[model samples]
Target chain A: QKEVEQDPGPLSVPEGAIVSLNCTYSNSAFQYFMWYRQYSRKGPELLMYTYSSGNKEDGRFTAQVDKSSKYISLFIRDSQPSDSATYLCAIGGTYKYIFGTGTRLKVLA
Target chain B: EAGVTQFPSHSVIEKGQTVTLRCDPISGHDNLYWYRRVMGKEIKFLLHFVKESKQDESGMPNNRFLAERTGGTYSTLKVQPAELEDSGVYFCASSQAPGSEETQYFGPGTRLLVL
Candidate 1:
Protein backbone atom coordinates (compact mmCIF):
# COMPACT_ATOMS: atom_id res chain seq x y z
CA GLN A 1 0.00 0.00 0.00
CA LYS A 2 1.12 3.59 -0.54
CA GLU A 3 2.50 5.16 2.60
CA VAL A 4 0.03 7.99 2.50
CA GLU A 5 -3.39 8.31 0.89
CA GLN A 6 -5.73 11.27 0.36
CA ASP A 7 -8.81 11.88 -1.73
CA PRO A 8 -8.03 13.90 -4.82
CA GLY A 9 -11.10 15.98 -4.24
CA PRO A 10 -12.26 18.81 -6.42
CA LEU A 11 -14.55 19.44 -3.48
CA SER A 12 -16.58 22.59 -3.97
CA VAL A 13 -18.22 24.51 -1.16
CA PRO A 14 -20.01 27.78 -0.83
CA GLU A 15 -18.40 30.71 0.85
CA GLY A 16 -18.76 30.73 4.65
CA ALA A 17 -19.10 26.96 4.66
CA ILE A 18 -16.95 24.58 6.59
CA VAL A 19 -14.31 22.60 4.73
CA SER A 20 -12.62 19.46 5.95
CA LEU A 21 -9.64 17.79 4.34
CA ASN A 22 -8.27 14.46 5.44
CA CYS A 23 -5.45 12.00 4.87
CA THR A 24 -4.54 8.52 6.08
CA TYR A 25 -1.14 6.97 6.54
CA SER A 26 0.12 3.44 7.06
CA ASN A 27 3.38 4.29 8.73
CA SER A 28 3.14 4.29 12.47
CA ALA A 29 6.58 5.81 12.72
CA PHE A 30 5.51 9.22 11.48
CA GLN A 31 5.46 11.75 14.27
CA TYR A 32 4.75 15.07 12.64
CA PHE A 33 1.75 15.96 10.49
CA MET A 34 1.44 19.03 8.29
CA TRP A 35 -1.04 20.64 5.93
CA TYR A 36 0.06 22.61 2.89
CA ARG A 37 -1.83 24.95 0.60
CA GLN A 38 -0.86 25.19 -3.06
CA TYR A 39 -2.25 27.64 -5.54
CA SER A 40 -2.11 27.22 -9.28
CA ARG A 41 1.50 27.56 -10.55
CA LYS A 42 2.87 28.06 -7.06
CA GLY A 43 4.67 25.78 -4.66
CA PRO A 44 3.10 24.14 -1.62
CA GLU A 45 3.01 26.52 1.33
CA LEU A 46 2.97 25.31 4.91
CA LEU A 47 -0.48 25.94 6.36
CA MET A 48 -0.79 23.98 9.58
CA TYR A 49 1.60 21.75 11.50
CA THR A 50 1.03 19.46 14.47
CA TYR A 51 3.21 17.08 16.42
CA SER A 52 1.94 13.74 17.62
CA SER A 53 -1.83 13.78 18.26
CA GLY A 54 -4.52 16.20 19.39
CA ASN A 55 -5.48 19.51 17.78
CA LYS A 56 -3.73 22.70 16.82
CA GLU A 57 -5.60 25.82 15.82
CA ASP A 58 -4.46 28.96 14.10
CA GLY A 59 -7.02 31.58 13.28
CA ARG A 60 -9.70 29.97 11.10
CA PHE A 61 -7.71 26.78 10.45
CA THR A 62 -7.47 23.75 12.67
CA ALA A 63 -5.36 20.61 12.32
CA GLN A 64 -6.14 17.34 14.03
CA VAL A 65 -4.17 14.14 14.25
CA ASP A 66 -5.17 10.73 15.55
CA LYS A 67 -2.09 8.58 15.83
CA SER A 68 -4.18 5.62 16.87
CA SER A 69 -6.02 5.65 13.58
CA LYS A 70 -3.17 7.12 11.58
CA TYR A 71 -5.53 9.80 10.38
CA ILE A 72 -5.04 13.55 10.03
CA SER A 73 -7.34 16.34 9.10
CA LEU A 74 -7.44 20.06 8.35
CA PHE A 75 -10.60 22.03 9.06
CA ILE A 76 -11.31 25.43 7.62
CA ARG A 77 -14.08 27.41 9.21
CA ASP A 78 -15.85 30.24 7.43
CA SER A 79 -14.20 29.29 4.17
CA GLN A 80 -13.64 32.01 1.62
CA PRO A 81 -12.82 32.14 -2.05
CA SER A 82 -9.30 32.94 -1.04
CA ASP A 83 -9.13 29.45 0.48
CA SER A 84 -9.66 27.90 -2.90
CA ALA A 85 -6.58 25.84 -3.53
CA THR A 86 -5.12 22.35 -3.29
CA TYR A 87 -4.67 20.95 0.18
CA LEU A 88 -1.86 18.48 0.82
CA CYS A 89 -1.24 16.36 3.86
CA ALA A 90 2.34 15.49 4.74
CA ILE A 91 3.66 12.93 7.18
CA GLY A 92 7.18 13.70 8.34
CA GLY A 93 9.85 11.37 9.59
CA THR A 94 13.33 12.20 10.73
CA TYR A 95 14.52 13.92 7.57
CA LYS A 96 11.94 13.36 4.87
CA TYR A 97 8.26 13.94 4.22
CA ILE A 98 5.73 11.75 2.47
CA PHE A 99 3.02 13.84 0.82
CA GLY A 100 -0.44 12.85 -0.32
CA THR A 101 -1.95 13.59 -3.71
CA GLY A 102 -3.46 16.94 -2.85
CA THR A 103 -7.21 17.61 -2.80
CA ARG A 104 -8.28 20.55 -4.98
CA LEU A 105 -10.87 22.78 -3.35
CA LYS A 106 -12.95 25.61 -4.76
CA VAL A 107 -14.98 27.98 -2.62
CA LEU A 108 -17.70 29.79 -4.48
CA ALA A 109 -18.55 33.40 -3.80
CA GLU B 1 13.98 37.24 4.94
CA ALA B 2 13.32 35.75 1.55
CA GLY B 3 11.77 32.30 1.12
CA VAL B 4 13.24 29.41 -0.81
CA THR B 5 13.76 30.17 -4.50
CA GLN B 6 14.02 27.82 -7.51
CA PHE B 7 15.34 28.81 -10.92
CA PRO B 8 13.99 28.24 -14.39
CA SER B 9 10.39 28.21 -13.20
CA HIS B 10 9.50 26.11 -16.20
CA SER B 11 11.43 23.94 -18.62
CA VAL B 12 10.55 21.76 -21.57
CA ILE B 13 13.09 19.23 -22.74
CA GLU B 14 13.17 16.48 -25.32
CA LYS B 15 13.50 12.89 -24.25
CA GLY B 16 17.12 11.72 -23.98
CA GLN B 17 18.22 15.32 -23.32
CA THR B 18 19.65 16.72 -20.13
CA VAL B 19 18.35 19.31 -17.69
CA THR B 20 19.54 20.77 -14.43
CA LEU B 21 17.33 22.33 -11.74
CA ARG B 22 18.63 24.69 -9.13
CA CYS B 23 17.42 25.72 -5.67
CA ASP B 24 18.60 28.38 -3.26
CA PRO B 25 17.38 27.72 0.24
CA ILE B 26 16.56 30.28 2.86
CA SER B 27 19.74 31.59 4.45
CA GLY B 28 21.05 29.67 7.45
CA HIS B 29 18.77 26.69 6.92
CA ASP B 30 20.79 23.55 7.56
CA ASN B 31 18.51 21.08 5.85
CA LEU B 32 17.51 20.97 2.18
CA TYR B 33 15.20 18.56 0.37
CA TRP B 34 14.22 17.66 -3.20
CA TYR B 35 10.79 16.32 -4.15
CA ARG B 36 9.01 15.49 -7.38
CA ARG B 37 5.38 15.09 -8.40
CA VAL B 38 4.59 13.26 -11.58
CA MET B 39 1.35 13.82 -13.45
CA GLY B 40 -1.60 12.77 -11.30
CA LYS B 41 0.69 11.34 -8.62
CA GLU B 42 1.48 12.33 -5.10
CA ILE B 43 4.56 14.34 -4.32
CA LYS B 44 7.47 12.09 -3.42
CA PHE B 45 10.72 12.76 -1.68
CA LEU B 46 13.93 12.45 -3.71
CA LEU B 47 16.68 13.31 -1.27
CA HIS B 48 17.83 15.40 1.65
CA PHE B 49 21.00 17.38 2.26
CA VAL B 50 22.49 18.65 5.45
CA LYS B 51 24.91 21.35 4.50
CA GLU B 52 27.30 19.98 1.84
CA SER B 53 26.59 16.41 2.85
CA LYS B 54 23.76 14.19 1.72
CA GLN B 55 21.96 13.02 4.81
CA ASP B 56 19.58 10.73 2.97
CA GLU B 57 19.09 9.90 -0.71
CA SER B 58 17.15 6.68 -0.50
CA GLY B 59 14.26 8.08 -2.52
CA MET B 60 16.25 8.83 -5.69
CA PRO B 61 14.71 6.90 -8.58
CA ASN B 62 17.88 5.63 -10.21
CA ASN B 63 21.48 6.28 -11.21
CA ARG B 64 20.48 8.67 -14.00
CA PHE B 65 19.55 11.24 -11.39
CA LEU B 66 22.25 13.20 -9.60
CA ALA B 67 22.05 15.90 -6.91
CA GLU B 68 24.76 18.03 -5.36
CA ARG B 69 25.11 20.75 -2.76
CA THR B 70 28.52 22.35 -2.88
CA GLY B 71 29.73 25.05 -0.44
CA GLY B 72 26.72 24.20 1.71
CA THR B 73 24.62 26.79 -0.09
CA TYR B 74 22.59 26.36 -3.24
CA SER B 75 21.91 22.86 -4.56
CA THR B 76 21.35 21.27 -7.96
CA LEU B 77 19.64 18.18 -9.34
CA LYS B 78 20.65 17.00 -12.80
CA VAL B 79 18.89 14.49 -14.96
CA GLN B 80 21.01 12.90 -17.66
CA PRO B 81 19.24 11.44 -20.67
CA ALA B 82 15.89 12.34 -19.25
CA GLU B 83 13.08 9.98 -20.02
CA LEU B 84 9.47 10.80 -20.82
CA GLU B 85 8.53 9.54 -17.40
CA ASP B 86 10.76 12.19 -15.88
CA SER B 87 8.30 14.93 -16.64
CA GLY B 88 7.02 16.36 -13.40
CA VAL B 89 7.09 19.30 -11.02
CA TYR B 90 10.28 19.46 -8.97
CA PHE B 91 10.03 21.17 -5.60
CA CYS B 92 12.81 22.29 -3.33
CA ALA B 93 12.34 22.80 0.39
CA SER B 94 14.48 23.87 3.31
CA SER B 95 14.10 23.67 7.04
CA GLN B 96 15.88 25.28 9.91
CA ALA B 97 16.97 21.89 11.25
CA PRO B 98 16.71 18.13 10.73
CA GLY B 99 13.96 17.42 13.21
CA SER B 100 10.58 16.15 12.11
CA GLU B 101 8.69 19.10 13.63
CA GLU B 102 10.68 21.83 11.93
CA THR B 103 8.65 23.72 9.33
CA GLN B 104 9.83 23.38 5.76
CA TYR B 105 9.59 26.29 3.35
CA PHE B 106 9.19 25.35 -0.29
CA GLY B 107 10.15 27.13 -3.47
CA PRO B 108 7.80 27.94 -6.34
CA GLY B 109 8.87 24.67 -7.98
CA THR B 110 10.25 23.94 -11.44
CA ARG B 111 7.68 22.59 -13.84
CA LEU B 112 9.46 20.20 -16.19
CA LEU B 113 7.99 18.72 -19.32
CA VAL B 114 9.95 15.91 -20.92
CA LEU B 115 8.67 15.58 -24.43
Candidate 2:
Protein backbone atom coordinates (compact mmCIF):
# COMPACT_ATOMS: atom_id res chain seq x y z
CA GLN A 1 0.00 0.00 0.00
CA LYS A 2 1.15 3.57 -0.57
CA GLU A 3 2.49 5.18 2.56
CA VAL A 4 0.53 8.36 2.21
CA GLU A 5 -2.51 9.32 0.16
CA GLN A 6 -4.07 12.70 -0.56
CA ASP A 7 -6.63 13.91 -3.04
CA PRO A 8 -5.02 15.93 -5.81
CA GLY A 9 -7.71 18.56 -5.67
CA PRO A 10 -7.85 21.66 -7.77
CA LEU A 11 -10.02 23.08 -5.03
CA SER A 12 -11.21 26.60 -5.63
CA VAL A 13 -12.64 28.79 -2.94
CA PRO A 14 -13.77 32.38 -2.78
CA GLU A 15 -11.50 34.77 -0.95
CA GLY A 16 -12.03 34.78 2.81
CA ALA A 17 -13.30 31.21 2.74
CA ILE A 18 -11.74 28.68 5.01
CA VAL A 19 -9.70 26.02 3.23
CA SER A 20 -9.09 22.56 4.58
CA LEU A 21 -6.60 20.08 3.11
CA ASN A 22 -6.09 16.56 4.35
CA CYS A 23 -4.00 13.39 4.00
CA THR A 24 -4.12 9.82 5.27
CA TYR A 25 -1.20 7.54 5.91
CA SER A 26 -0.91 3.79 6.32
CA ASN A 27 2.25 3.76 8.40
CA SER A 28 1.93 4.09 12.11
CA ALA A 29 5.69 4.57 12.36
CA PHE A 30 5.41 8.02 10.88
CA GLN A 31 5.99 10.43 13.73
CA TYR A 32 6.45 13.65 11.86
CA PHE A 33 3.68 15.29 9.85
CA MET A 34 4.01 18.51 7.88
CA TRP A 35 2.42 20.80 5.35
CA TYR A 36 4.29 22.59 2.57
CA ARG A 37 3.22 25.21 0.09
CA GLN A 38 4.71 25.38 -3.38
CA TYR A 39 4.29 28.09 -5.94
CA SER A 40 5.08 27.53 -9.59
CA ARG A 41 8.78 27.36 -10.41
CA LYS A 42 9.71 27.42 -6.72
CA GLY A 43 10.48 24.66 -4.28
CA PRO A 44 8.19 23.63 -1.44
CA GLU A 45 8.21 25.87 1.61
CA LEU A 46 7.52 24.59 5.10
CA LEU A 47 4.18 25.85 6.25
CA MET A 48 3.60 24.08 9.56
CA TYR A 49 4.57 20.77 11.13
CA THR A 50 3.44 18.63 14.01
CA TYR A 51 4.91 15.68 15.78
CA SER A 52 2.62 12.70 16.45
CA SER A 53 -0.93 13.72 17.21
CA GLY A 54 -1.80 17.28 18.03
CA ASN A 55 -2.95 20.53 16.54
CA LYS A 56 -0.55 23.40 15.97
CA GLU A 57 -1.63 26.89 15.13
CA ASP A 58 0.49 29.54 13.46
CA GLY A 59 -1.28 32.73 12.45
CA ARG A 60 -4.06 31.75 10.05
CA PHE A 61 -2.67 28.28 9.44
CA THR A 62 -3.59 25.30 11.60
CA ALA A 63 -2.09 21.81 11.27
CA GLN A 64 -3.74 18.85 12.91
CA VAL A 65 -2.48 15.32 13.22
CA ASP A 66 -4.52 12.38 14.43
CA LYS A 67 -2.20 9.50 15.01
CA SER A 68 -4.88 7.04 16.01
CA SER A 69 -6.58 7.48 12.68
CA LYS A 70 -3.38 8.02 10.73
CA TYR A 71 -4.89 11.19 9.37
CA ILE A 72 -3.69 14.79 9.16
CA SER A 73 -5.02 18.09 8.00
CA LEU A 74 -4.13 21.73 7.27
CA PHE A 75 -6.66 24.50 7.57
CA ILE A 76 -6.22 27.97 6.23
CA ARG A 77 -8.51 30.52 7.83
CA ASP A 78 -9.40 33.75 6.08
CA SER A 79 -7.88 32.62 2.82
CA GLN A 80 -6.77 35.17 0.26
CA PRO A 81 -5.54 35.20 -3.31
CA SER A 82 -2.00 35.19 -2.00
CA ASP A 83 -2.70 31.79 -0.45
CA SER A 84 -3.17 30.17 -3.82
CA ALA A 85 -0.67 27.40 -4.44
CA THR A 86 -0.15 23.64 -4.24
CA TYR A 87 -0.39 22.22 -0.72
CA LEU A 88 1.62 19.11 -0.01
CA CYS A 89 1.30 16.79 2.95
CA ALA A 90 4.51 15.12 4.03
CA ILE A 91 5.12 12.38 6.54
CA GLY A 92 8.38 10.98 7.80
CA GLY A 93 8.76 7.33 8.66
CA THR A 94 11.88 5.80 10.20
CA TYR A 95 13.93 5.74 7.01
CA LYS A 96 12.16 7.65 4.26
CA TYR A 97 10.39 10.93 3.67
CA ILE A 98 7.03 10.44 2.00
CA PHE A 99 4.96 13.11 0.26
CA GLY A 100 1.45 13.13 -1.15
CA THR A 101 0.37 14.38 -4.54
CA GLY A 102 -0.34 17.97 -3.65
CA THR A 103 -3.77 19.59 -3.73
CA ARG A 104 -3.92 22.70 -5.89
CA LEU A 105 -5.66 25.49 -4.06
CA LYS A 106 -6.93 28.69 -5.69
CA VAL A 107 -8.44 31.44 -3.64
CA LEU A 108 -10.27 33.54 -6.16
CA ALA A 109 -10.47 37.22 -5.48
CA GLU B 1 21.91 33.63 5.30
CA ALA B 2 21.10 32.36 1.82
CA GLY B 3 18.77 29.39 1.49
CA VAL B 4 19.66 26.31 -0.51
CA THR B 5 20.54 27.30 -4.09
CA GLN B 6 20.40 25.18 -7.27
CA PHE B 7 21.96 25.87 -10.68
CA PRO B 8 20.35 26.11 -14.11
CA SER B 9 16.81 26.83 -12.99
CA HIS B 10 15.66 24.97 -16.10
CA SER B 11 17.27 22.57 -18.56
CA VAL B 12 15.90 21.03 -21.75
CA ILE B 13 17.95 18.26 -23.30
CA GLU B 14 17.23 15.40 -25.63
CA LYS B 15 17.37 11.82 -24.50
CA GLY B 16 20.84 10.21 -24.19
CA GLN B 17 22.46 13.51 -23.09
CA THR B 18 23.99 13.89 -19.67
CA VAL B 19 22.80 16.58 -17.30
CA THR B 20 24.41 17.65 -14.08
CA LEU B 21 22.41 19.56 -11.48
CA ARG B 22 24.14 21.24 -8.58
CA CYS B 23 22.97 22.14 -5.11
CA ASP B 24 24.62 24.30 -2.49
CA PRO B 25 23.15 23.72 0.93
CA ILE B 26 23.01 26.27 3.71
CA SER B 27 26.26 26.71 5.56
CA GLY B 28 26.59 24.71 8.78
CA HIS B 29 23.81 22.30 7.88
CA ASP B 30 24.97 18.72 8.32
CA ASN B 31 22.17 17.00 6.39
CA LEU B 32 21.34 17.27 2.71
CA TYR B 33 18.56 15.67 0.71
CA TRP B 34 17.50 15.25 -2.90
CA TYR B 35 13.89 14.87 -4.07
CA ARG B 36 12.15 14.90 -7.42
CA ARG B 37 8.62 15.38 -8.73
CA VAL B 38 7.57 13.99 -12.07
CA MET B 39 4.51 15.30 -13.84
CA GLY B 40 1.27 13.96 -12.32
CA LYS B 41 3.16 12.43 -9.43
CA GLU B 42 4.03 13.31 -5.88
CA ILE B 43 7.44 14.55 -4.84
CA LYS B 44 9.63 11.61 -3.90
CA PHE B 45 12.89 11.31 -2.01
CA LEU B 46 15.95 10.32 -4.03
CA LEU B 47 18.74 10.24 -1.46
CA HIS B 48 20.28 11.95 1.52
CA PHE B 49 23.80 12.94 2.55
CA VAL B 50 25.39 13.51 5.89
CA LYS B 51 28.52 15.54 5.29
CA GLU B 52 30.56 13.69 2.68
CA SER B 53 28.94 10.40 3.55
CA LYS B 54 25.71 9.05 2.16
CA GLN B 55 23.37 8.32 5.03
CA ASP B 56 20.75 6.68 2.85
CA GLU B 57 20.38 6.35 -0.92
CA SER B 58 17.57 3.81 -1.02
CA GLY B 59 15.32 6.05 -3.06
CA MET B 60 17.60 6.47 -6.05
CA PRO B 61 15.77 5.17 -9.14
CA ASN B 62 18.60 3.24 -10.73
CA ASN B 63 22.26 3.09 -11.71
CA ARG B 64 21.85 5.72 -14.42
CA PHE B 65 21.74 8.42 -11.74
CA LEU B 66 24.62 9.24 -9.46
CA ALA B 67 24.79 11.78 -6.62
CA GLU B 68 27.88 12.97 -4.88
CA ARG B 69 28.53 15.19 -1.88
CA THR B 70 32.27 15.63 -2.03
CA GLY B 71 34.32 17.31 0.72
CA GLY B 72 31.13 17.76 2.72
CA THR B 73 29.99 20.80 0.79
CA TYR B 74 27.95 21.43 -2.33
CA SER B 75 26.49 18.33 -4.00
CA THR B 76 25.75 17.23 -7.53
CA LEU B 77 23.30 14.81 -9.17
CA LYS B 78 24.09 13.62 -12.64
CA VAL B 79 21.90 11.65 -14.99
CA GLN B 80 23.68 9.91 -17.85
CA PRO B 81 21.79 8.97 -20.98
CA ALA B 82 18.75 10.61 -19.55
CA GLU B 83 15.41 9.04 -20.39
CA LEU B 84 12.15 10.80 -21.08
CA GLU B 85 10.88 9.42 -17.80
CA ASP B 86 13.73 11.23 -16.07
CA SER B 87 12.20 14.63 -16.72
CA GLY B 88 11.13 16.29 -13.50
CA VAL B 89 11.79 19.08 -11.05
CA TYR B 90 14.69 18.23 -8.79
CA PHE B 91 14.73 19.85 -5.37
CA CYS B 92 17.54 20.03 -2.84
CA ALA B 93 16.90 20.52 0.84
CA SER B 94 19.07 20.76 3.95
CA SER B 95 18.48 20.57 7.64
CA GLN B 96 20.60 20.80 10.74
CA ALA B 97 19.67 17.21 11.49
CA PRO B 98 16.86 14.68 11.01
CA GLY B 99 15.13 15.55 14.20
CA SER B 100 11.37 15.26 14.40
CA GLU B 101 11.10 19.02 14.49
CA GLU B 102 13.94 20.68 12.58
CA THR B 103 12.94 22.54 9.47
CA GLN B 104 14.32 21.43 6.10
CA TYR B 105 15.10 24.44 3.95
CA PHE B 106 14.63 23.91 0.22
CA GLY B 107 16.25 25.17 -2.94
CA PRO B 108 14.50 26.84 -5.84
CA GLY B 109 14.63 23.49 -7.74
CA THR B 110 15.96 22.66 -11.21
CA ARG B 111 13.46 21.70 -13.88
CA LEU B 112 14.73 19.03 -16.25
CA LEU B 113 12.96 18.45 -19.52
CA VAL B 114 14.17 15.45 -21.50
CA LEU B 115 12.64 15.40 -24.93
Highest-scoring model, lDDT: 1
Please give the range of 10 consecutive residues that has the lowest summed lDDT in model 1 chain B. B96-105
lDDT of 1 by residue, A1-109 (tens): 8899999989999999999999999999998899999999999999998886999999999999999999999999999999999999999978789999999999999
lDDT of 1 at A97: 91
C-alpha displacement of B19 in model 1, angstroms? 0.6
lDDT of each: 0.95, 0.92
Residue-wise lDDT of candidate 1 within B8-49, one digit each (tens)?
999999999999999999999989999999999999999999
User: What would the TM-scores of all predictions be?
Assistant: 0.98, 0.97
- Taking all chains together, the TM-score of candidate 1 against the true structure is 0.98
- Clashing pairs counted in every model: 0, 0
Distance from true location, Cα of A8 in model 2, Å: 0.7
Write candidate 2's Cα lDDT for A1-109 as tens digits: 6789999999999999999999999989888888999998899999997786888999999999999999999999999999999999999865356999999999999
Candidate 2 lDDT tens digits, B10-93: 999999999999999999988899999999999999998989899889989999999999998999999998999999999999
